[model samples]
Target: MAELEAQAPTPERGLAVRGLRLAFGDTVVQHDVSFYVAPASIFVIMGVSGCGKSTLLRHIIDLQRSAVGDISFDGQRLVNAEPARRAALQRRIGVLFQSTALWSSMTVGENVALPMQLHTHMRAGEIRDQVAFKLALVGLAGQEQRMPSELSGGMAKRAGLARAIALDPDYLFLDEPSAGLDPITSQRLDALIMRMRDALGLSVIAVSHELPSIFTIADDSIYLDNQSKTAIAHGNPRHLVEHAEDARVRAFLKREPIDEPARATTNEY
Candidate 1:
């Protein structure tokens, strides 16, 4: 495990976006947004259904093309980086989708090992051990051969998380951690996310509409209001609730936070 920890990339601090833009024909998704994601920060990007937060995230990861602006990771421009350098940069980051996105046909161990197998030439036994260690790290020890179909929804998300953390990524981008989770499961997941963030020293980019999740783990956030066509607010969610000057931000914060499976509390604790 020491080698794995050492294998982790040099922790990159901060992500910069300037004049970022994205549009589809006549429909614009993002409108010249600019912000900074501080290092090791669980920076939540929140918004209503059509505000383009996710689209902006995709551009950060280079998964989608931006119409204009600059996105740099630790000073390396994601939009303009050379191919090989970009590939190296990407290996240091990991992503978790709204869906668990596990391969239904593979076992837990197989799923976790896929990225390593594709990226390295490690022999079979070593890969197996690595898989076991990663699963254990995520509290899923000894469930290596279980099929994805057999997992509960929460377990599936945990498994996906295990895979995401397997490489000990320096930066993690999660689309939605509590999208479909029950309150208890979401709480458990939140604890795990914080634990892993500390344990692995990762910078997290979390996207969600769930204010509870944002408040519990986020150090800061960027809120995009679809009607405003810009990030209506940015800062600590707790502070934003009481201090934001924008009407849209006040309305957004005042709305009761809700999630399926009914969480125990709505405050971001």
Candidate 2:
């Protein structure tokens, strides 16, 4: 136990969730959920549809409050933190919703520049340069004037990603990033995600059940079970598929039949 403790990554400089419970009015979504996201790592939240995967992402990014427990970033409290403090912390975080959510009325460049325009005193020239740089990073260079409607599904997703990283945030939150993308496009996006993580040192928390995306990008992951209303597994996705003791976890990862009864157990590999 002492050796294991000594070898564990410290949560001081990363995202940490302790006994988190989420609810909507009288209904509970999840309970006793706990996990740690080490800095510069890609962590995935994965489960079947309607398993509250996206809801958990919402809680992490402060869109919805957890009914119990706490969420912290770099040792600073995010849950129940003062508004000013929370805003300051959130400025270092960027989010890309499942739909991408780019403003249809704006050009791709305008969408990318909006965050800096609203949040920083960077001059127009500076914002423009930053916008170009971000767009180029996402392989959308020289296409800034294009509107969202003109872009293909893959191109639109990339454009949205450019906007998400506009401020060069330390943490990136992505909800269903590959939802409507083709296999090839999804693979390219996965590669881009890894490259950005390496280049920017971002700690990414993504909600995805896409097997290919989850296996390709996740350094670690947590499986949220809707029936149990809690997390049942945590570890590297590749490792969990074969080594997970829980039948449900292995079944989910390997895309096999889950004939075993649902047993609530938070096992970390």
Candidate 3:
């Protein structure tokens, strides 16, 4: 069982989940899941559909209760922290949901400014300036007047991302960002994530099932196994693809052909 104990997490560990177990009612979703995300690194959570990938994210973000384990960020324990502390910790975190989660009634600029409006006392001019900067950073410059319905899927994703960073969070969490995007658009989004990481030194936690995107952006990843109800593989995607001892892991990596439609092709030999 997860205790209500709160021990300050070490600062060097950007986000840490230890001995985590999750369940909904009587059904167990995950077991003993542990991982540490270093600052400025992109850590991916990957697994087959219904394999508890999103469940893990929910626990880390404190959106769902874990049956057992503890979660901490930047020296604060999220599980038993005071409401004020929890809110403060969450403000340093940003999340881009699978749907982009933009409001249809709001314009792009309004959507990006919403976080600042809610979280800070900045003047309207400052919010506008910050929105403009974030939009430019995401390659959506001058589209502030555009509606969510007006954007292509990729553009909408970028807008959602801009909103996520409006408060300039230290950690970012993306859930299946590449879902429903075309190959080129997905690759572009992956590159954008890297650029954001490099520019802002973000510690990113991404939950993804997209194989190509997983390999391209993740510095470290943990693969959850539905059967064992725990993580079956953890490491660099490239290294795991080549050297994971588990047959299931090797099979999963080999299941996709390199020339598959969604895979990015390179010109290099």
Candidate 4:
């Protein structure tokens, strides 16, 4: 594992977002968004649908170039870093997309080993050993040969998580990690996330609107507002719910749908 450990980042630190602005052609998603993800902490990005939560995530992972602002990981600028530098930064992080993003054609073990095969000079035997270790960590041990189609939703999410951490990244990004999961399964996943943070000291950034999951796992959070075109609230989800000055933030936490159309009714004269 020395080769894998050799690629790890030195002097652990957190992620910082400053003055971030994102747009696509004529439409702007978010602007002037700023927040900090503490080292080894689980920070959540949350908002209603189309509120640019994912867009902000894309910017952080360098999937989409931000129209303005800067993002730094461990003190290195990510916005305009050199290609080599960007690639190096990428090696220190891992992302689990909303869809799990596993290849249907590949077995679970193969899916997890793919990244190592692409990025490292690790021997096949070593890769196999690491793959097994990660799968075990995620509670998916001995299911390496199972296809994506063969696993349940919870199993698949766990498998995807294993794949994300195969390289032992210092930072992990998850997009709606509990989407479509049952409450029990979601809670289990949240627990796994906590274990990862506590045990590995990995900083995690998650985008989720599941209140239970968010409150269960988030150490900090940033809420993007579509109307404001920027972050409107930032803090622990529970703290924000209880004391945030924004009505919308409180409404969201209360599970009151803010935009539901009023029902039509005939009044008796």
Candidate 5:
């Protein structure tokens, strides 16, 4: 039940979702799921496709309805907050879609400036400076005049990331950032994410099925098991790959990368 009305949660510094559950009509999507994202740390949700991770993220961003459970900021509850308050909080949060979500018609600089123009009273020159700074930070400084269609897949991802962080958000959410990139580019993006974390002290929430990327950037991760209907493991990827007790975990660890066609099967050393 959506409750007759929607209430916004109060304001806080960090994000916490408590006992969140969602459903569509009769089908349950989530079941009593809860997680806390500490400030300045990368929190990763690593699961195979369709494990309710994206829905959980939507609840965190206050974009989706939770059938039950309350979402809170540092001390305030967001579930019951007013629109103005929600807007205030969301301004400090940035989300990067898997597709990069850049407007095909807009140039990279325009895309980055869009957030500032919408959220702040800064002048055009100030916005331009900010946009340029973000582009430089993402290694796309002079490339702003380029449109989305002009960029390679990796460059587009970085440009979208530039836009996401242009507002100087305290928290960043990336949905499969390295999804369609080449191996080298994907690895480069991973390094860039680490750099951003160190430079800006961003609290990042990344969801991906890419195990290699998970191992590359994950300080901590949670794995969802659809068969058992629960989260089976939540910890460091290296340790989980080495010591997890679940059979599924072992199997997942043993599975080879099937999507990359550049290489053939080799012994798992």
Candidate 6:
């Protein structure tokens, strides 16, 4: 397993979330969530099913507003910034959704090129070159002409990742990046993620429940509890498995039986 090397120190080049609260109308999902993602580090949001892991990702990306707290990227305010400023801030971040969210109608090349085209004035030829370069970085070279429907599940995920880094963004956010893949495929994806972090100096924030992937790639992690609707543990996943004070957190990390009765399973946001 390849380990992520430490990056050169750069002050203020990271993400900060302070007292974040998530809600949908009268239903408050989580409250008082706070975490920091250091520059070029891989930070993971983890928990059991229905713990609002995905919902927290949406808030950080500004797709959904938080009920309380502030989010900052490299010292720039993300939440409640002026629209133009917020948009500018967002352009520096990239996201790969759980579904990949590639356009079924477009070829993989087109998908990768879209962000550059929309955000920059690069000529068509330059975009083409960049698209190829990004695809190659994800081990998807020569796959430009293939449509999303033509890609297998793993290919589609890589394609989506290619698109995510298209603009050379500083931060990368992934939602359930290893979901539904076999163990080998998942391990490959985990390796790819570490490579991206090392090669690009990206601060990565991922929402996931896959224990293997979590242990393999995460430099830091926070476990959100569904019942408490807040983070119960925060640290390296491996450390937490053995040392977490919360029994629920330890049980989840170690895949042991929880003492309490199971709650009705609900879809995680």
Name the top lDDT candidate.
Answer: 6
What range of 10 consecutive residues in model 2 has the weakest lDDT sum? 1-10
Instruction: Tell me model 4's lDDT, rounded to 2 decimals.
Output: 0.87
What is candidate 5's TM-score against the reference?
Answer: 0.87
**For candidate 1, lDDT tens digit of each residue in 1-269?**
32332233432557777777677777676675777787767888987766787787788888887646776678676666789998987888888888989999999889999999988788999989999998998889999999999999889998998888767788898988898999999999999889888888788999888877888999888888665577778898899988987766766767844332443543220
Order the candidates by lDDT, highest first — what do you get? 6, 2, 4, 3, 1, 5
Ranking by TM-score: 6, 2, 3, 4, 1, 5
**What digit string (tens of lDDT, one per residue) describes model 4 on residues 1-269?**
32332233433367877777789876777887878898999999998877888888888999888656777888787767899999999999999998999999999999999999999999999999999999999999999999999999999999999999988999999999999999999999999999988988999999998999988999999988867778899999989998988888988877876764353642110
Tens digit of per-residue lDDT, candidate 6, span 39-117: 9999999998778999999999998986478788997767668999998998999999999999999999999999999
In candidate 3, how many Å is residue 130 off?
0.3
Q: What lDDT does model 3 reach?
A: 0.87
Better of 1 and 6 by lDDT: 6
**Candidate 5, residues 96-166: lDDT per residue as tens digits?**
99899899999999999999998899999999899989999999989879989999999999999999998
Q: Write the per-residue lDDT of candidate 3 for residues 1-269, one digit (tens) a residue.
A: 44433342345558888888888877788888888898999999987777888878888888987646888887677877799999999999999999999999999999999999999999999999999999999999999999999999999999999999999999999999999999999999999999999999999999998888988999999988766789989998889988987767766666643222342532110
* For model 6, the run of ten residues with the poorest summed lDDT: 1-10
Ten contiguous residues with the weakest lDDT in model 3: 260-269
Which 10 residues in a row give candidate 5 its minimum summed lDDT?
Answer: 260-269
- Against the reference, the lDDT scores of all candidates come to 0.80, 0.88, 0.87, 0.87, 0.79, 0.90
lDDT of model 3 at position 168 = 94
Between candidates 3 and 6, the TM-score winner: 6
- How far residue 192's Cα lies from its native spot in candidate 3, in Å, is 0.3
Query: Listing every candidate in turn, what is its Cα RMSD in Å to the true structure after a full C-alpha superposition?
Result: 8.8, 5.2, 6.7, 8.1, 6.6, 6.1
Positional deviation of residue 73's Cα in model 1 after best superposition, in angstroms: 1.3
21 Cα displacement, candidate 3 (Å): 1.2
